[model samples]
Target: MTRSRKTTQPLVKICGLNTLTVVDAAVDAGADMIGFMFYARSRRAVTPDLAQALGEEVTGVTRVAIVVDATDAEIDAITATGVIDMIQVHGKEDPARVAELKARTGLPVMKALRVATKEDIREAEAFFGAADHLLFDAKAPKDMKGALPGGNGLTFDWTLLDGLKIDMPWMLSGGLTADNVAEAIRLTGAPGVDTSSGVEDKPGVKSPERIRAFLAAVKQTHLETAT
Candidate 1:
């Protein structure tokens, strides 16, 4: 639903914000989007009221909700608060579920596709027209114990997506930080980027300084990559 892929500004989204300081840093640092974790299973989860409070601090950054395998009631309850601008489904929600949620909320939906191999990208085809955006994250290992779905800070082979193309717009995430986001962006040609643990000092704790550093890295990345 956004502009065509031919334009590239490299939008950056800073996720897992649970504090005002980090929120301010992201905004001041020029992040295009800011995400709040609402999944109870995630260590970075925040309450609806708290999300509203945090959202108030961001005057311009797009507010986002990162949700997991939640029910309609849960999603609606959060949407009712009227603070979230986008809903990021980081679970096993299929294309039909994506359509249902979009119809009910009248809000844009971002479908997350966890990638570990070439075939994984095809899994996202179903969501092309169904979702407003796509987020590519590293797939969690099936046998690895204690994997808590998305936001595990897993990193896949970035090279796997080199020169890749897709119908729907997408963002790249997973183990991305200020240190390597530029190289990752160059390799994958991802038009947008999302960061979680990469900007946090600890699980559920975001650092303002880290946020600034991260934004600076992306600005530099954009310059270096541009001819």
Candidate 2:
């Protein structure tokens, strides 16, 4: 389900990286950022020690720690590892909390907004100045089984973000893959793109081939668009 080779080369982020092998695959695939999940409820959850080790192996790629409404203690434990470059809040954190987490961890914050409607996009305004970056993701249906915060692999209407202006840097995520990512970028003009299950063989298992293909697809977009 991929598109013709196009190349916008939007800032690519590979999320839900757990093991060192997958980490290497993402890094080798030219990911701009690598995300490690810390939410205990998630199948992709990794311990702080593991994240630290994996983060150490990466040189150029930014390492991000993903949490869902985590307590100060939980966040402290993860940041204490010193491997994470950014903290991604995937929970219902208010702007004050976002600011507090940024100050406490001394790392830039990316707040995720689960969009089900246009109002959800509007909600992002609250985090404008509080967070360093914004991530727009699909909001899981209330009846969906075992739904986690951000990686449900559901796609919202890209047209919702078309011509929408916001202050902070942002990334387009949720159900993005090599197949449709080019169109997604074209529709939204996103500065960056993120993928979790889209590159995985299963919920937590990352396929190296898929990772390489996804990156190649993203890079192709930049090439096609530049010409």
Candidate 3:
């Protein structure tokens, strides 16, 4: 079942967080969610132990674990730490797998769809009943070098999501930074926004200043919209 919206404000998620400094930065900046990558291949990946330590620095923000095609054992290990509040599947997990993960972990599961075209957005329907939430991220081209499942810092045409309709809460991700997040949110009217590489100094190194700036921009947009 889809989770109900928690607040009226647009959610801000700072993803790919690995260090306590970045974790604290995100929480202090009023991010609604903070994501710790569990996919080993990604530079942002962190062990469950490290994630737990970093999570300790968080208080109110939801903590999310991002995994790509993890096995049952891996999932068990990650959940065992009791650090994650939500699970985000970023690989080729089908609707059934999404449901299975929720049943197995008893945590809300979010399915991420990497989109390059409108047809990709339509794929959200397949996960409707299973995933509690959805995340739409940019899909890197086939020939793009060193592109992991996400955090490529590549963006799709926002126009593709102009008339997007889905059953559950969703977030707009990919290539989002402080300078453009306001525009992205205005264009797509996304209930939430997520960033990984966008707030990074390099591929997995998060910039605390960028993180604060991004959150500030989102807050400004919300304030403007409310008036």
Candidate 4:
């Protein structure tokens, strides 16, 4: 489980890592979780062979496999490698599918809830038992060009999470950066946070320095909140 916002640093998940160098940087800099993209449409997508190698190098942190509306065959291929520690469904998967994925993979599942309003937030309650964790992310506008399932780098109003009453571990995501993550955490009271484009030098290209900076910012927030 992730630490509560009032107790210690939020669990930082650096998403879309396509290389081992950035993975090393994030883990070494104290990231609690690291994400690998499996959705074929994503620029950061990696083959099962490569993911296995990278997952092998992962140590002392959760190794998450991020997928978007993946097929059972595709999921089977990913889990077959026996490297992924968790599954993050970031598409239009329903609660049943979420539960199925958990049973099929035998790994904890985190269902992504895209939020643009209160109704979106309310939808998360349905997945309470289906998912091990819930992730609240910004919903991309329909007019946005070339938008994939996630990693759009957009942020919703943080106050929308205020007074949320879900009864499971959850994470805040979307448009989170080293600059604004502390404020986002303060507003949402999330126990964990996720970042993709915010720390990237470009799409699918992670910057080592930015990874370190983002983790440092999260640590600073924990220190301030603890005091």
Best by lDDT: 3
Q: For candidate 4, which ten residues in a row score worst on lDDT?
A: 1-10
Error of 3 at 168 (Å): 1.3
**Comparing candidate 2 with candidate 3, which one achieves the higher TM-score?**
3
Model 2 clash count equals 10
- TM-score against native, each model: 0.93, 0.95, 0.96, 0.95
Model 4: per-residue Cα lDDT at residue 68: 89
**Residue runs of model 2 more than 4 Å from their true location after superposition:** 1-9
Tell me the TM-score of model 1. 0.93
Residue 99 accuracy (lDDT) in model 4 = 89
Residue lDDT tens for model 4, 48-142 = 99988888886568889999899999999999988899999999999999989988888999999998999999999899899999999999999
Candidate 1 on 104-165: residue-level lDDT in tens?
88999999989999888778778878999999999999998778767777889997786577
Scored against the true structure, residue 213 in model 4 reaches a CA lDDT of 95
Candidate 3 TM-score to native: 0.96
Q: Model 2, residue 102: what's the lDDT? A: 87
Off by over 4 Å in 1: 1-8
Instruction: Tell me the tens digit of each residue's lDDT in model 2 across 1-227.
Output: 11122223578999999988888888877888889999998989999998888887877678899999999999999999888999999998999999999899889999999998999999998887899999999999999999999888899998899669986789999999999999988889888999999999999999898999999998898778778
